[model samples]
Target: MIQELNDEQLERYGRHILLDEIGYEGQLLLAQKRVAIIGLGGLGSPVALYLASAGIGQLTLIDFDQVDLSNLQRQLIHNQQRVGQNKAISAQQSVELLNKNVKTETITTKLTDDELLKITKQHDLVLDCSDNFETRYQLNRICHKCQIPLVSGAAIRWEGQVTTYDFRKNKQPCYQCLFPLKSNQGSIQESCSQNGVIAPLLGIIGSIQALEAIKCLLELPTLAGKLTIIDGLTMELRQFNITQDLSCPVCS
Candidate 1:
């Protein structure tokens, strides 16, 4: 039998249950779902917080780095006091504080190819909040192999982008398609380190990533196979239709 929530959860999630789309059934589904976020930096911060606040039953956060003063600008979940603490632990603490009912698992080790498969096997969805291309590529491959859905987001300078690749969904492009093998060899690949990002820019992108993950978990309208790009400077937003590539090595 499916476990029913107690009075506290019912009341706490009353607003969500009130939605016709996310009525009692949807809220219950969310409560039973598990999600994993691979990075605990700027984007992962908001993703974990919002999901926990929304009463996601289980969240696994992975990050090898510790908190630093430089991260406070956009990594909203961690504070000055948390400096020197593992980011995964800090994010888990933040989530627990927001909602004690939510369960958090913190992995303070860098994710390797083997570890990725082992850990992600049990998750319902994976959120790629890592800033590096190598980690992103690894996540895409593993998730594709395991047939898990992935929601990825990136922010640098004034630009932010969010996309969901549901490999289970027929003909959906994986992250590798958008970023082909040829681009990986490029020299001008911009990153947060090279081109500084606006502080709130991370928040904007991270929040959207969380939203997308939530929707994906609840099996609602998601950004799967679509890219939503936002320009923080001008506050302009645009969505592009994306299709799966037949020759794409990752998912094809």
Candidate 2:
């Protein structure tokens, strides 16, 4: 059943309704969207906030890690009071304060393959803000298997990268196609804990991820099949076309 926007809804989302790309109808479409975010750190923080701000109907915030004092520097969604709390729950609290109309589900435990698939299948899109390759690889496989769209983002030191893997079609290039597990790439874990990312790097990449997600939901042109890398120091942005790896195990 389609829902007519009430007066308060119209007022709350007035800015988005004014845009040509996201007018009243597009705002309504966004309201019907269901999104699952795989992390609640720096990257997931902006992604969740912007998605909620855009009136995404449902959001599932999944993160088993707990927030620490160090996270306050970059993870803007959480505050000093929420430190030591599970990231997903903390993020949920923040989202509630941001938009009452948005529904949020928090998962604090590590998910198994079946559990992850079930959650991913329930959402219209998935965003990978995870720090490790294991989680990224797992999500890539699940999203590809379920034919769900995925927006992946990562930041380390002064560099960040973002891309969308549109799995709605067959033989689409995936995250695994970019960084395979068989090679030493997956073994070399480069995370914020070790590398220390700049504060705005996550924001730049995650914001783009959110925008790409919105574009995907609106059936507009997105960063699908393309990789965008950013250098925060130089402020240089480079884009590369992402093609399917015929010999890749996941997509091929």
Candidate 3:
């Protein structure tokens, strides 16, 4: 279905239109894409907002959390007035306010294996914005099985990481391939909530995840087989090539 961009859409996406890489055709592709973002907290906030502003047609958000006073520091999608409301619903409100052309679907319950498989199959891409390893691994597993692209991001204190898992491409590593099990670095095994992350760090990682999703949806070349790591303190970014492990339980 060809969607003619009205005056409002053209005005809203003027900068995108100016980009040589993402001309009118790329913009149209974005408008027809659907992305599922798991977790509407710090990371999901920027990803959802950017995707909506960029004119992504459909966005499915899953987060069992409610807006809390603590989340205000980093989770920009929710406000004090929305405290006690579900994060997914609050994020939906934020996206709708950003751009009415974007459709938002809020899932208020925790993501289960069955729900993850079903919801992931319906989207062109999946954003693993959740804070836990279990959630990230589960989303990657489903995406790999369904041959859907997955974008994963994380931030803690002065460190951050973002990667694209394009299972549709052979020999590309999924999240589980890189971090098979939870890191033994901490008692809880590297959770953002417990480890603490700088407020702006989420913005950096989340925005990158959004960019990766856009690139993946438009079939543009991206950081599919590399893990991009960031150091917030020094503002240094490094890329590590990742290869599919034949021993990986998810892909092997």
Q: lDDT of candidate 3?
A: 0.88
Cα-based TM-score, every candidate: 0.96, 0.97, 0.95
TM accuracy, model 3: 0.95
User: Which regions of candidate 2 deviate over 4 angstroms?
Assistant: none
Each prediction's whole-model lDDT (CA) = 0.88, 0.92, 0.88
The order by descending TM-score is: 2, 1, 3
**How big is the positional error of residue 66 in model 1, measured in Å on the Cα after superposition?**
0.8
> TM-score for model 1?
0.96
lDDT of 3 by residue, 1-252 (tens): 437777888889989989999888788888888899999999999999999999998999899989999999999988999999999999999898889988889899986788788888889999989888767767878898999999999888899999899889887887877876645225436676677889999999999999999989988888898999999999898999998878888888
**Distance (Å) between predicted and true CA of 177, model 3?**
1.4
Residue pairs with backbone overlap in model 3: 157-197
lDDT of 2 by residue, 50-158 (tens): 9998889999999999999999999999999998999999999999999999999999999999999999999899999999988999999999999999999999999
